[model samples]
Target: MRFCILGLVEVQDERSGLRVLPTGAKQRALLAALVVKAGHEISARRLIDELWGGHPPANAANALQIHVARLRRLLSGPAERDADQPERRPWIETTGHGYALRLSPAETDAARFQHLTDQGRRALLHDPGQAGELLGQALSLWRGPALQGSVLGDICADEATRLDEHRLAALEMRYDAYLRTGRHGEITGELVDLTLQHPTRERFYDLLMVALYRCGRQAEALAVYERARTRMRHELGVEPGPALRELMRRILHHDPALARTPGPRPADPSQPRATPAPADDAALSLGDEMARLHRRIERLQREQDQLLRCFRELTASAAQRDMSVNWEGS
Candidate 1:
């Protein structure tokens, strides 16, 4: 069985696929708190405090015990049975005054990700190339938002924030690697997405503009700066920082300094730019074509409206003539 905490909390038994925890919110909270603090024993009192936020009920301890029992049963259920032991087993083990999930540090994706990132950072001083690969590997562990569908209290919220910071650092480290290797074009789209997602992150915007300029898309690079400037003015009532302003100046002056510096001698010959996925390229192109089609449809509807108006006028005139002739005969 493996517990994944890099994103949402999930437990998977190789034999039985994925296991869904019982439905109670507090019950799930109890499990998530333990999972985040995995490998360490959490005191029963602390668990109660976390669940109830200090003003726990008189029966809070009893309630916690009940929740723990339920979680233990779920973990030890038939789905998690091991061949070595015919008896069902509980993954959570009890300490003198606390409980710990019986999981090796390696069994959790979150732990492994953090470990790899730490190693990468240390390796960076000696071998940036190897550090970049390790950081990239660490980043691939995240599937989505951490603890999705789970409500986080004060402590869990802090843990989530710390985890996110680590992920971002790993991403920046990877970007640095790409930059070092002169893979400027490859980082452009990613930097664009990152800047959009984290609009206030000035560094992302700077990196994006640099990447764009390096790829010889000077016009597009200037446009990106303009967009970032507009966004900052409107959203935050501020201007771009010194670093971004300097980048813009360099770009406008066509500074040779803006060009990608060749890496240490014996640089690999530049490879052809990889084609973007067909689905993504098609979606972008289809968006423009769809807009044109909509405009054409609107124009046709207007022409149809004019034809209908003229037909109505002709029908009224003919009806009036018939009525006038009938009146004259009478």
Candidate 2:
């Protein structure tokens, strides 16, 4: 059974699919705690404290064991339950510290989402189409809120919060890729929705302004900056950041650079990529110096060769003159 914590803390089976988990809130919370702390030992004390919130039962250890047992049983999918095969290893491992949920990165959607988000971020500038696709796949893993409907302890809540942040970052990155790939018209409406959903996230407003300008809605683009400025001033008592302000200035001045160009072209996978241009000024200067020195060395060699030829010609001419003088003497 695969543990999906990107959305709800649900289980998915390959053969039967979407197995129902125990209805008990604590049971789900225990499973969530283990999954969040997957592969790490969690002491019984910590688990009890988190589960009971300073009100652990007299038989806390036994209650915890019962929950672990139920979770172990839940891990066994219908295929495992129906199989006449030999007994498989348990999903929960008992450790000297306490217990650990036996899970790997591949077993959880959260890990996959993170992996894809990272890959997309790395590809954002060069291969934006592929980046958009990867980021989309990552975002798609989120069915709703992370660990949705599960009673969360501190560990689970922290993980959920982190994943939510990651999701928002991924959304911004994907939208950036979309804009870079000339999908501006398509994303403007969505950007508007995002601005409403996450009013404090300034990046969305920045992107929406750009998208609107590209779509030839210059007035709306400027109006977006006004809205952002008004919101920040009214709520946060600060002006928009330099990025938004700069964008506003450029849009107001009708900067020609804001006009849409074709998005980054998809690179061919079969072909080896050309070396990227040097990003550092020092590196570029060094490369140019090396090139200049090589050309100077070649020029100096040519001059030396020409001088040698001249010297040889002078010697030959002097020798011929001497021979003539000797012949005249003879």
lDDT of each: 0.74, 0.79
Model 2: lDDT to the true structure: 0.79
**lDDT of model 1, residue 114:** 90
Cα-based lDDT at residue 144, candidate 2? 87
Over 4 Å off, model 2: 77-88, 262-330
lDDT of 1 at 94: 86
Tens digits of per-residue lDDT for model 2 on 1-330?
567887767777756655656667788888888888888999988898768877889999999999888877877654366465334356788999689977776778888898999999999987888999999999988888988776547878788889899999999999999888778878988999999898878999999988887776666777787788778878899878999888877866557777744345655699874331212454335434544664696699799999999999999999999999999999
lDDT of 1 by residue, 197-260 (tens): 9887777777787777677666667667777877998899998899888887786666776675
**RMSD score of candidate 2 (Å):** 20.8
Q: Pick the candidate with the highest TM-score.
A: 2
TM-score versus the correct structure, for each prediction: 0.68, 0.75
Top candidate on lDDT is: 2
Candidate 2 clashes between residue pairs 3 or more apart in a chain or in different chains: none
